[model samples]
Target: MAADSTRPVRIAGASGSVSDRRHAVSMFAANCGDDKVDVIVGDWMSEANMTARGVMKIEASSNISTSKSGDTFAFGDAGAAYEPTFIEAIEPALSDIEKHGIKVAVNAGASDTEKLAKVMTDLIKSKSLSLKVAWVSGDEVFPAVQKAHAEKRSKFENVSTGAVLDNWEFTPIYAQAYLGGLGIAAAFAKGADIVVCGRVSDASPVIGAAVWWHGWSRDQIAELANAFVAGHLIECSNYVCGGNFTGFKSLESKGWHDIGYPIAEISRAGQVVITKSKSGGGEVSTQTCSSQLLYEIQGPWYFNSDVTAVLDGLWFEQLGTDRVALRGVRGELPPPTTKVGLTARGGYQAEVHWFLTGLDIQDKARMLEAQIRHALRDWSDKFTKFEFTLNGTAGENASNQNAATVDFRVFVQAREEKDIAAARFLRPNIDGMMQGYPGSTIHLDVRQGFPKPIYEYYVTLLPQADVQHKVHLWDGQEIEISPPPQTKTYPAQQPSEPEATGVASTDFGQTVKGPLGWIVHARSGDKGSNANVGFWVRHRDEWEWLRSLLSVKTIQRLLEDEYRGKKIDRFELPNMYAVHFLLHDHLDRGVSCSSSYDFLGKNVAEYLRSKHVDLPLKFLNRGKL
Candidate 1:
């Protein structure tokens, strides 16, 4: 395909290190010389940087090296992972902007906030930079904000900033900090035209910018939400524009090096055009963009800003080359809830490794287990539970084919601070062996470990009244909140079931719930995929009430009736309102290891209508809308 000329160029500049931030900004500015660019985005922080930051700061003095990866575990004293410093990456990006006449936004607080803000403030003092810079604080910013809020409990609003941090009380894996476009919006209000953020969910930038540009109102949340969806689609930058194109293999292409950042041209009408750096690589076709949108879309309740984005009304269409438009986007009023990120002391963990050889893989596994069991028996009272995974030459694909060799890995844990004491005491598991097959191939080692704290976050809604929006402006900065969409609905009718035990019996069909209503799964598939849709029942209560009627006697009655001399099997689809009972061996375990679907079976439509033919008047009504 070709690129669109009318769209403003969206640029993505890369900075390999924090020191390169200025260079990255300069590079972006040089590329946009004398031309108008709508938005400038940068990706500075990564996962490895967060872990290292927490560990080295324990004593208030960091002995930690300034690198992403910490010490190694294999070579005696390997360091832990390092987190990116906020100031190191963002300050330069800001500096580059001052050097060049460019307005941009960045992910600053994603790594470290106070440090990053200090970097920005320092740059302002040194260069006399009067740039409009948006601050993207890391997840850590929330705790500090919350602490201040709690201290000013009675005078909450006095201490509370208009832009509230989410999931602060509950610690989230990785950075749980959420930026709902407020910081970027604040920066836009300041007229910097450039926003720098850290750890803001990928889509917040676009959503914030769109809301700022459109002059939307708070009541227009659905439009903001629709913009949020567009942001979600492109925030990963190239991910939507063919970077990880599942349909195509070769990602390498000319001009891919100058991959422009993604741009969402959102209109007040909820019209969105997802395009990328005119200089970027790959195609922005519907297939490419839509696939990214579908990535990890867990279910109907797509949670964000503590609000559930009902995805049913959302639709996508490719309007032109490199332009995919979104429509039918709508959102419900946000739940009056605020989920806080909380951090707490967790459990202690440790592990050991051993290599076994000379055939009898199962025997080797048993022998290793015996050794660990005996060692644990000696100090069994000191620990909670032990877990083992003996991997080696036992299965069809063995690591060592020459002879049956097994690599035994063992893990032990407890809630105590020094829980590995029981494990350390059992160190002799490596040397002590009761079996005679221990030959030259035997090797043992007692692994050492340190107590590392694991952090997690949870989401709980607070009353909408508890959370307030605060808009900070620099000079003439304005806040625009989009209005919700106007909604319309239509009634739908179910298809008539084909007659069973008749010539017109060859047929099949699938059931989907009407718009907005959730389909329920009475039972789940064993393998954790697909649900067995036995029959479609209307009322939500009918599904609940049917389970109560399924007694052991009902099975006996069915056996004595139609299924008397025939064989029958049952399966359930865990995800939807469906179940399937195979009449005879009609469908083999062909499709999904479990027979959730039947391609070779007799007409299931006929069977469902026949089975429930004698349904009570109430039962028939229950299946209807």
Candidate 2:
């Protein structure tokens, strides 16, 4: 890549800690560098998270009327406005933000972003800081989603099932389209120090910073793609910093409790090096960086609101200590359509736990199920879900009592919260206590839990032309961005067979039937209903063996019970010596709808790691290689 006429830019990642706000803020403050970081960005918005925010607003609204009489959890709108995660997380870092001249960006402003911006401004004013605050708007596409069918512009069809939205089981609240960095770029160009967006793509902040700092245009697809990858790499903060990493054994021994957020040094010439703070814990290398790069990606063509990047040729290089440089990122014109995360009030859900101890656990579970079925025989049809899961198995001759106990859980999901909460619904098993099998016991919350509302996410595409992308500057100037006209789509690609390895030329190391974790590091997560599990090694020697050992057929066999002949796509990243598998509908359904034990599919990799595989003795001896 030829050098552009602009200097490089640096940005820090500070979120994916929406719920861990205090730690996020503290880490952000600790990561500030007066002469290093140029922009700090984070994203806390997601389909499920936004829906949860709406529920909080409704609950807070209900608490309002009672607050006038006394102090209530419902402080009303004030409570709703109270310390939003996006704004609140930055409060402790305000001083460092100004001192270091670091511009901050975040999408923590879920549904009530206007209020979030206002609260943040007031907080800034109280501190007597002259920070310019800007907020991106026009993400609200509810009106567009409602008329999508009538206008013939978009369809909310289930990606896996081909089911249309008209026959959806629940009522939708609203739809928010994923915006790109153009809005954030506009704000930065207009001199806004802080940018808050509602549903901007997670990597948009980094892209926006690069655009502003490097003075790049929309046509700089390669540069944009590089920055986009940089943003994606660090968007989840500690993820690339070894949180939930398969090689976390090293970090744990190093006392990585105060694991620092990462900082990316990006260049105008398309070079990016990801590094952690001087005071942080955790290490950054090619392995960790590659794990996150393929975190939620679908395939060769990765789509963002701004650009469609090609990751098939991507590569990474470790540059001394805790730094890794991403290289060979390429991008094509973005699709004409943008993805919208639509969520609706699904209904309500509740659960009860029953502990069955000792032997004959299966019989006890059967006995319990029969009694419950008999009690709810007439009302069984009322619930959307009525399930009994055996969460544990009693160990043979265990040293501890808990090890001999098996967990029997009963869960119910219904349209009405109170219906599941009915005393008759919860007390039946308790009513038959004496008739219960020997060693039967109940946990503290044997009674059904309080009703919790549910939200089902429906992801669909909307024509970008229909969305009005606007950026509001602190000075009341709103900039409208025209959507790029180019568009395309990528159908699922089939997995290719691995290249045959020579068993004759090479010393095929002695094999031992042990856990796969003994040789390889893995990371897995959900992409809608699909589960993407990626495994990589720290050494070049283990690449071929790792890749050849975990082909699609082997993966299917490893996860036989769960996969059950599902469509799975395999892709390899030679740059990172990694192989990834995309198992379709393997999660049963998505987070809200999935009946699987691992809802988000985060444990798929760990479960596979525990599976007995023919581990290469040589690789095991070189441990952490």
Model 1 — which ten-residue stretch has the worst lDDT? 522-531
Clashing pairs in 2: 336-487
Error of 2 at 418 (Å): 3.9
Best by TM-score: 2
Model 1, span 149-261: residue lDDT tens: 56754222101112123423323222234445655655665565455554555566666666556656656767767777776676556556665343333345534454444
Model 2: residues >4 Å from true position, as ranges?
A: 1-6, 30-35, 55-83, 446-448, 492-509, 593-597
Local accuracy by lDDT, each model: 0.44, 0.74
